[model samples]
Target: MEDSETHNLKRETIEQQYKTVRERTSNFNSYTSGGSHVMEYGSTSIKAEKIYLYQGFDPASVNFPPNELSHDTQMEAINQRDADILFLWHMYKNSEDGSKKKEILKQISETMRHRIHLDGSIDLIGTVLYGPAKGSVILNTIREPGLPLVDDWQCLKSMVRLFETHCGSLTQYGMKHMRAFANICNSDVSQSAMEEACVAACSSSHDPTQWHPSNHGYSA
Candidate 1:
């Protein structure tokens, strides 16, 4: 028989271990070859190729023929851009106060929402973590591009926090993979390509900012 406290502690430890295993396995065993990115955990692999084009192309340069960008193109842009933003937001969190970090999280959430509206659903975990504040900001930003959702300085401040927290130790290979996915998003990459790109983004490295790079890959 175990005491209440010991039982609680055991439960907590098991929960933590379970969470770790889930995270490790979430994107595991999903991979694709002949593309720009590769995601591998243990013996599993997920390939993400769409992101490669998204990262490489300039959003402004894309011509949309008097209509909004296509779903694929938009997704590519959002994934690549979010990766950069996430990297920045993570950096800011590490150096700032809790209050400031919370504010940054709000902004990120808003931006993420805006990207989602444009590109459709994103990685569910990333969407949930960023929360409503950032989601609202994204809405406002898209509504009035030049009107200032939050102060530019505030946005920059948040980005710094993101970099510190998430993208601080990103490897060159990881960056390459991320950029590859971005490029794929920007190009006319196929569903398979997109899947491969997402997998690559996931497997290339683990960072807080890059939580969902591969989440939407399979959906495509």
Candidate 2:
């Protein structure tokens, strides 16, 4: 009986060690150990160093408050330009190198200027949140202008879909950038279909009526 118990304890310890080893080295494709070695969700085996060096930081971290938000604010801004454009613009502007920042900002400004001509509006809508310690600004694409009263349920639904479609795409873009970085590093990372799907879905959500400088509000 003593011998049996000792053997079982050793078996359990070995099993735990094996699991730990699998988790630590699982990111490399060559480390597979049968069909059961797939990493599970919420697993910590993924290295933050690998992800960060590959993808940089979250867009929100670099861009501030993110371009997508919930509908729990007093005001929301609608703009003719996609929120991701602004996010990218901000990222480029705040990049570490001054010359690179200027180049990116110029590209974004030119793109925005062209979009304003095509759409006839350059309006942006955003919410202001005030607090004692600090304040935050949450911005999102408004489907219309002049703050038409919105149904709460409808707003919630729209926000959900916006997050699911728009913000999700941004996250996928970060992932793609990460994959590109990994490739540069000689890692076997591959591009994702999610990147293409995100672009198509975001483009489809755009409404022409939301164009800036509406004739009713201002003269061309």
lDDT of 2 by residue, 32-57 (tens): 33212544455555432232342333
Worst 10 residues of 2 by lDDT: 121-130
Poorly placed runs, candidate 2 (over 4 Å): 1-80, 120-220
lDDT tens digits, residues 1-220, model 1?
1111112221223333333333333333221221133233552121222222323433443442321223222111224534656675876767567877777777677555434432322232123323445532332223235643333443333332232232232222223223222322233334443344334333333333433323222111
Where is model 1 more than 4 Å wrong at Cα?
Answer: 1-79, 120-220
Residue 95, candidate 1: alpha-carbon lDDT: 53
Relative to the true structure, candidate 1 reaches a TM of: 0.20
Q: Give candidate 2's error at residue 119 in angstroms.
A: 3.6
- Number of clashes found in candidate 1: 66
